[model samples]
Target: MNIITLYHGSGGKGTHELIDNIFYKYFYNKILDQQGDSSIINNINGRIAITTDSYVIEPIFFPGGDIGKLSVCGTVNDLAVVGAIPLYLTAGFIIEEGFDVNDLEKIAISMANAAKKAGVKIIAGDTKVVEKGKGDKIYINTAGIGSLRNDVNLGIANIEVGDKIIVSGTLGDHGTAILCKRQDLNFETEIESDCNALNGLIEEILNSKLKIRFMRDITRGGLATVLNEITNHREQGILLDQNCIPVREEVSGVCEILGVDPLYIANEGRVLVVVASEHSEKVLDIIRNNPLGKEAAVIGEVVKDKYGRVLLQTNIRGTRILDMAEAEIIPRIC
Candidate 1:
């Protein structure tokens, strides 16, 4: 019997094998070895950006984008979240022995086009082949490096009480779309992953508001995980107005039916922003003008609280704890 099973996608035992055998080994530069959520590369002549991620979404193809397009955009968006001018990317591929060459060509072309759209280049890459069953059709690992604008200093440390929190667009599209594709679930409204590159939107916001405190792409763990990260660190609570949070009816219906929370579902093309209250409108305008952030909205605020927690105020004016979900959602989701 093949020891390989679906469990490999879990964040537990099988995930450890995949990371240890493939990811950590090949990506084992001294910098990544440090493992600080993201890689910290030195020798950056000026402001620098670095991000690393792996893509193993099931089915490889989706409604709006493919794994290839996702690989490029994902890297660019990571740098964008940091207020960086994304300029370069590195893609690594692990292909099973009997994969499709024509499809691989399509994947490569899509990546190239995505990089071009994001105004970046794929400067370096690596490829490997594995035994058929040991690997999926193909897995992509991407690492990106970009230069930050000298004037922009976006980070979690910039978050503060009274700062307004914003979401670039609607939520739960990515996870719902992927789940829909993998399973037989059907609905009147189809939700496509908001897969996109946000460098342009970031650039627009930076030009308009230099004081923008923090920004992050709502990726695997979605908006909730990101907000929790800040609360856990700053010892401040994030209070979100239920009405202010943007969600398409399709996405909301899907979540309600499937027992998932839109807040925790993955979002590919959305950004979470924390900025000064007074400048929130200015930042919002900059985002609205950009195509990537047209649906941008002010969703929440940072507040003084005894507990470092994230709370959601419902439409009924009641507050509930928005805790992180324990189960691995949409495994290999990134």
Candidate 2:
């Protein structure tokens, strides 16, 4: 039996067998697998936004979303965060041979729905099949390209000390949902995945009367990690009121029981926006009215700080530091 015993990476017969049997079979797409030293790609007009990601989410199916939707939404968000309007995407899949085709089709449909919502096209894709027990039921790798428009320059450097931080909804739902699915943990209220495309939010910001300095979707490392990354570009500190932060009761309860900080949890549908202090209210208002951002709120503000740290303004009216974790608080949940 050609059971992969984790030596697939070894340069031996088993590795070759796995590669030849699985990868080459399903991943047969045009303009790929060529032995050329470099690929000849046609050129277009403006700068291209490129982002790649691999999905290995445990359980594959969860409360609010599955790996398929996450794969698409995650790619679209990556492009949107950089001020690029996503245009095209490519999906590459590695599937276990005995995996259920009906489940795979459901995933594909969910992915298609997500792409439609984001207004991007899956122009090209490849698929491969592996022997059972060799690979997980499925893993998806996505590469996307988008065109960055003129007059839309946004990045961490654009973030100023006085900028306001806006969150597009509640946090910790996605993480808690996956955790519940993983351990069969039950709760009074089911935690749903926040996996959704932020394209509409970005579109509204671009087309509407609001101005944004910078934006990031709170994902893997969560809101605190994202803000910390921005602080690296400038000497900015973030101050947030613990009570002002919008979190669902169920999510908070799960976090409390699990001893996990909700701020460190992942969110797929939510986004963090840094708006210029002058236009903070308008931006927040626009976000709050949008379909994807109805629960939005101004969570914090950038500050001038020697510490260049993130502080939590506790309900007791005291300040405490929030530091990034060296190891992941939750693993394989995204």
Candidate 3:
């Protein structure tokens, strides 16, 4: 069929055809080829990390990546930040009845390529078709499994005064790109989404055996929400230097025009790292050496005063509270 139909989800002839032509064709692997009710993964050692997320991005396709790529990366990063080695992924698709078959194949191809690059397998998946207008063109849900590192112990409770707050790269690229695309805003330079898998980058730091207090992937709620969430009800507060936070000129300009705070903008590829002061410099050096972390910087520190608060020291040397985002600034942003 040129376009998805309800029959494709009936678990009969049409369903088999759809699975064989697209899902099975692209996501082929030894484990997936078995075609069993569930994938059997063995030889796993140490603690296991599993994360699941649903992607309903407004536009199925975006600047640097699409919803398919976003689904895999989002799930993988969730595991990576928890100090895990990502190994397998399961993707589920919900396509509108009238969705284009070519588009579906493109998305499947993107997912396959992304999984390959992330060194993970798409072991199993499910697909469903809904009535036209009952759903968006497409939506994706993914679950990732990983093995936790025995040497690494990370948590917010480990945060102590004088610990450094490091962001892997500039902020707001992903949110800004989605906004510009949805609003049809034009600019001198293109603002592409920073969506990417961070397992490799995270592994590099974990391999160093540094003293990491905590690590989190910068996603939906952005840095502001993450900082506020971690510092909330805690003995130690976090103080951020406005000038120290890395932000691309293009992103800053976009935020200014749109009257949006970059700190509240979502980032898919960036990571927030908290490490002891002594190991901060070495951690920064290691992050900077990687392509995904070239713009990494120590933006803040845990403080003893202003407990349970996130304070930002502005470029003008004035401090202000950076609270959790109360409302959604942009919708359907992965």
Candidate 4:
């Protein structure tokens, strides 16, 4: 009974006990305590944004966070970047038979703590068990809902020539950390995943009255991919200064050894902010004031071009077209 078994997912006494002792123990709230099939959310009286994501990270536990924290943060960030104030979340778990109960509890605790920090509620969740060898230790899926701020207008359509592009923080930390853990690559400096909830930082920026054009959390496709995506089919291209983009030395070293570019690596907590040049400096100051955005920098800007493209100004005074990643750089990197 110390480990998860098929009976624990059978929706019987065992399943009820699991919910009472684990999920409810930490996530208990007036709304979720109702234990209904669908939790009712009352008094949400504005535009709402919703987003869903699944986490199947190779190592359930990483240096700075685990899959549980990643799941909540990822979903919350998705909603926040869309000019929303994250409010509620729903989680689903697929746990394999023979998984350690202690590990499961730890993950649940992580999720609960992350939810509390993000100031959101876990309104509902589901659990399922898979055959021992049929699944990984665990996989988590989360959906987030947030009330949209009426004052904010964010989209690619609002992007224009002379707009400034800002990145919240260092890139490739999450991807490099996962890669090191998976590949067992040892180095003098340890890389930790920058997995964190960005709702607070994002909300502050949105409330600053800046002309924020667009925002996106840098995830699977990395900064280059996001830039390429935003510039697609636009009249203006994006030009980036190579030196301004923040990349930890250790991360850069690992990318160099692996023959990869950090720009194409994934990040969990990082975001791309596109704002008009007039308000870019104020926006940067606001971002830097937050703990999650201490390393924020204005790395690029929109420029005139017939063909929308993302161009990087190399340190060697050469420019190159930065394209979307053709293939997955690292798989299962949340």
**lDDT tens digits by residue: candidate 4, 49-136:** 9889999998999899999999999999999999999999999999999999999999999999999999999999999999999889
Model 4 residue 298 distance off true place after TM-score fit, in angstroms: 0.8
Report every candidate's CA lDDT.
0.80, 0.79, 0.92, 0.93
The number of clashing residue pairs in each candidate reads 0, 1, 0, 0
lDDT, residue 238, candidate 1: 94
TM-score of each: 0.85, 0.86, 0.98, 0.98
Would you list the rank order by TM-score, best first? 3, 4, 2, 1
Q: Model 4 segments beyond 4 Å from truth?
A: none
Model 3 lDDT tens row, 1-334 = 7999999989899999999999999999999999999998888998899889999998888899999899999999999999999999998888899899999999999999999999999999998989998899999999999999899999998988999999999999999999888888999999999999999999999888989899999888899999988989887789999999999999999899999998998899999999999999999999999999999999999998656889999988899999898875778999
**Candidate 1 backbone collisions, by pair:** none
lDDT of 2 by residue, 161-246 (tens): 88889899998889889888888999777999889999878877866545578888999878878878877645778998888789
Give the number of the best model, judged by lDDT: 4
lDDT of 4: 0.93
Q: Which residues of candidate 1, in runs, are more than 4 Å off?
A: 1-45
Q: Write the per-residue lDDT of candidate 1 for residues 1-334, one digit (tens) a residue.
A: 1233345444576546654564454334454455444444446568787899889977798877889989989989999888788876777787776677556666777886787788876655556667778789889998888888888877787778999998998888888888888786777766688999988888888887557998888987888888888788557899999999988888888788778888898888999989999999888888888887888999989999868889999999899988765684768666
Q: Which stretches of candidate 2 lie over 4 Å from their true place?
A: 1-44
